[model samples]
Target: MADPKPALVLHLATGGEPLLFALTTEESGKLAGKLAQLVKTGAVESVTTKDDSVVAVNFAHVAAAYIDDLARKSTVFGMHA
Candidate 1:
């Protein structure tokens, strides 16, 4: 068998914003479509990535939201980006 295909994960948001996720990738085309919808609806920001770096289109908003989200989750030691 060949190696699994790398996911085409688009950046959603980062910096511990609430209700945000890292390198978002849906399992199927259907899920991808839904994700695109979310982006269009302002539920998430568009992320562009190159190599290991990620950039968020709505950085300030996303940063605040993510920080809040991580505090609430409190899975700091358990989760890795």
Candidate 2:
């Protein structure tokens, strides 16, 4: 069988339970770059997720982001360690 694909993890601190989303490799890189640009330049009107979820948050709410390339233990859900 073939191996599973990696994901891009976004960690956002929402004051309560943090908001987490898993993005694809391509999306992750693009998001990272855009976030950096927004931090340096201006704001982003809106953004979408891998699951087609739309998200709109202030640039200051972005806590952290990472690319997870490790193998997932289960195939049912695209989750990683």
Q: After superposition, how far is residue 59 of candidate 2 from its true place, in Å?
A: 1.0
For each candidate, what TM-score against the reference?
0.26, 0.47
Q: What is the lDDT of candidate 2?
A: 0.54
Best by lDDT: 2
Root-mean-square deviation per candidate: 12.8, 5.7
What stretches of model 1 exceed 4 Å from their correct place? 6-8, 12-26, 44-81
**Candidate 2 off by > 4 Å:** 1-18, 66-81
lDDT of 2 by residue, 1-81 (tens): 455344544455454443555565666667765665554453543556668777775655555444454455543334433
Candidate 2 global TM-score = 0.47
The C-alpha lDDT values of all candidates are 0.36, 0.54
